[model samples]
Target: MEPLLLGAVIVAAGGFAFLNGFHDVSNSVAAAVRTRALAPTVAVLLAALFALLGALLGTSLAVFFVGAARGLPPGTNGLAILLTAVVAASGWNVLTWYRGTPSSSTHALLGGIVGAGIASRLTSGPAMEGAPEGFLLRLILPLLLAPVIAYLLAYLAVFPATWLLRHASPARVNRGNRMAQAVLTGVFALGQGLQDGQRTTAVILLALIGTGSADGVGIPMWVQVFAALLLAAGSLFGGWRITHTLGHRLVHIDPMRGSTAQGVGSAMLLVSGIVLHLPLSGTQVMASAIVGAGANQPFASVRRPRVVRVLLVWLGTVPATALLGAVLFLALSPLLQS
Candidate 1:
């Protein structure tokens, strides 16, 4: 990788991290605001704090994602591969944000990796590589199962919660849920940082090793810190559109449903990304959890049209990003070669 190309790739990765912060804010803290449990400013601030913490606390996800990058053909241009992936992922993220859709940053990156990897194989003769079968299976299967797990987990949590609080007065239930919302929102925010922040770290790491700045596979502490800080800074603004969609448009979020939905989504991210080692999307999980939470409400129909639209966006993220990545790589092939 050329120095100029490497530096350009790093700038693109940083932009992606910045977008990730803002793009995922609603996913982390919308429930708190929606339930009136936390002010929007407080919610975002807390989200920022915990996101930075989560990014600093874990390196496993970063390691795993870097390994995924390694799965691309061995002799392919690493700078080109990373640039293509970053460009596609960021482009998709911006489009989705403008449309007020909470699409998956993780999926966008993965799709870009897959697409660019394919493109490399086509253009680089035998040196560029394909993804390892084990890696692909691990990546794709968990991604497929994530929404279902989120829905079921959220439904199970909310249904039983409502039933448990049935004997309480409405006011008492609301108060309790509000308290829960405060705690869960922070937890979800932390997990978002842990899970999503590491992704940006992976890209940066790829750029470093590919461009010959780093000596080995080990990620520097500064990289983790930089990724964390960038993510938190990103969270400081520009998430209101998705916030509205999740907090108000998906369903009428009461205190209990808001807390429960966030809790379920947070737990799903912890289990899938941290425990099971799957880099699933916080946005998709939260969206599915919101629907599940709505279903548990007394006679709510779950807003089928909104649900359908969100689902469509989730389903389209990978393919759309993959196609975009492929085109980008092809378009820039000459520059990449130079």
Candidate 2:
């Protein structure tokens, strides 16, 4: 029973990573594709390659999820919490993907765990008490801050990028920016992999730890490879609906602004994942950068209505997924606990 539950948790984690790949690939490639810097095919392939590299290379941000896993009640309860969290997050990802909304998989994942934790504690008593505030401070706060920072950085960077090319011919400027955007898109994807790939890997690790199959000392190579490959595979599938929203509906950006936004988004993701040991939403950061870069244009070009809808979804994702996670836990707990 324990082995089966553990297997379910790992499978759910992989599914979430795949969903994450399609859901968030827009963040990495939308700007480049929209600017005609890279064909959609080339952009996706590049993203897949780098995303795999990024995931396989780093596990710095796994600490938070691992800590969360350790906090859950041992045995079936812990496995169920992990399973339901991944399941709930994956459900939200599918819904958002179907609706063409670019929501945060990071928040959804965190919310799932938190929701399941809270539900477990409430129903099963103090044995499952979990630190929701710790999740807030360590993971959520950084994720929330990353997008705002991305927007500001993108907003400021665009001026200099535009001014530098101000005197250049439009043809020459577009060509150069396209090339730069292509490179930066891959970089952005790499950072994204680093940020998101560790998330599923962490969940899998937590399940292993819970079942005593492994200690929580370090990420297993097989786990990293599995998560990375699934994430890369999902990237290959690409989420064109959300891609349309990101590249077309959310903002109107030229080659220069698109390049600038990609650059800022990539830098933020890399820094947060590698240096700060933080888990952030590549979707949020990239989308915020796009809007910021577009803000310099006519106000109408920013697509206020679409932006508002996106923002509302962003604000609701964590809480909504939390509720979903709790409900899913209630629904699945009987089977898991039996």
Candidate 3:
């Protein structure tokens, strides 16, 4: 019965991870599609393929960081926490996607984990010491900073590109930028796979440790391959509504601006993945990059109100997921304990 229950929970978590990949697909490919660098179908395919490859090749640093750096005691209810986090994050992702808003799956997961941890503490009595300061400093801080840095870098990259190319013919600019956007789109997809894929990997590892399958030291080959495939399939399906919102409503992105945003966002994710072992949000980073790129243009060209609406969604994701996780955990605790 315990094994069955664990299996069920892990499968559900995997499903949630796939949904996360589906919803956030736009963050990586929207710019390319919108800039006419790639057709929608091709963009989705490329994003899915590259994301899968990135997941397969990249190290599972984020999972290790989550488990060991969090300082959770052995025998803690990690399975419950993993289940709650996945449910909360997935629920939020679907909701925001439906609303055509790009919310951070990263933030949702963070909220879910913290909510479950708090609830577990209340129920089980002060168990784990919570995530370490270094984890927060190294991981959480980067998650927070990446979007802002992406924004700044994007602004800088776009402004100069636009200025230098102003003397060029419109047709030439368009052609050059279109090709550049294609390359940037691939980089963005690679970064997305590195960052977002790691988050899913971390959650799966948490589930494995919670269920007592593996010692969180390393993820099994089967688990890794399965996760990569699931996420890639989800990315292939893509999120058209959010893609439209990001591609059209957020800002008018030319090839240069799109490239700048993609490059900046990719840099942030790569740094986090390789250096800090943090799992950042591709959606948040790209959105901010888009906004930053737009800010470089004339005020009239930037859609401030629409961007503000997206920001509002971002602010709400954490609290909303936390509340949902708490409620769900509270309702389930009795049955789980029994």
Candidate 4:
């Protein structure tokens, strides 16, 4: 029974990573794909490889998830709660992907775990207590603020990026920026993998810890490899609608602007994941960067309505996923407890 449950948990965790590849992964490479800086096949493949490398970069995000996992009550109740969170988060990921909305997988997962924690406290008393305490300071606030930071950084980067090539010809700048976009997009994809890849790996590790199959403290290397590969597979076959929405609708005038957004997004992800040890949303960062890149030109050049829709979608993700997680936990608690 324990082994089966462990397998189930690992599968659920992989599903989330797979969904992330198609949905959130699209954001990491959208600019490069849209601007023709890299072919779609090449871009996705590049993202997949780089994402794998990024997964191995460090495990801070994985450790964070483990902290959340530790808060879960041990035994069947804990397993059920963790499973429910994965299902709910994955469901949200599928829904958002079908709608072509660039929502945050991080937000969905957070909602899931938090919702599960709240539900567990109600269902089983003190076992689940204090589990959700550190999240606000560690995860939620940083997630909420990351997009704003990405927008500002990307927006600020545009003028300087453009200024550096002020003396260059349009053709020259375009070609050069295309090359730069390809490279930066690859780096961004790696960062995306680093931030998100460790996340699912953490979930799997938490499950192992909960089940007494492994120590709760460390994320095994095999788990990291598996998560990275699954995520990359998801990216390779990602939905193009998401790519289209972010690339064309938001901003993709040329390679230069696209490069500006992607470059900023990558830099932010690197800092957030590696330096600050935050599992910030790559989707949020990319989306905001695109808007910021658009701001480099006249306001009319940007699609205000579309941007509004995207922002609203991002804002709605947490609440929706949280509710889903809470509801699923309540519904399943009675069944799984016995």
For each candidate, the alpha-carbon lDDT, in order, equals: 0.82, 0.88, 0.77, 0.83
Model 2 C-alpha lDDT per residue in residues 211-262, reported as the tens digit of each score? 8888888788999999999999999999999988999998899999999899
TM-score of 2: 0.96
The alpha-carbon lDDT assigned to residue 123 of candidate 2 equals 72
lDDT by residue for model 4 (1-338), tens: 55666787789999888888878778877898888889988888888888878877888888886775566777667776778888989999888778888888888887787787788777854356565767647777788888998888878888888789999999999999999988997899889989999889888887888788878656688999889888888888877888888988876467888998888899889988889887789999899888888777755678888889888888787788778888988997766655
lDDT of 3 at 183: 79
Give stretches of model 2 more than 4 Å off.
125-127, 132-136
For each candidate, what TM-score against the reference?
0.94, 0.96, 0.93, 0.94
- The predicted structure with the larger lDDT, 1 or 2, is 2
lDDT of 2: 0.88
Better of 2 and 3 by lDDT: 2
Residue-level lDDT of model 3, residues 78-114, one tens digit each, is: 5666677678888888888898898888899878877
- Which candidate leads the pack in TM-score? 2
CA error at residue 62 for candidate 1, angstroms: 1.1
**In model 2, where is the ten-residue run with the lowest total lDDT?**
122-131
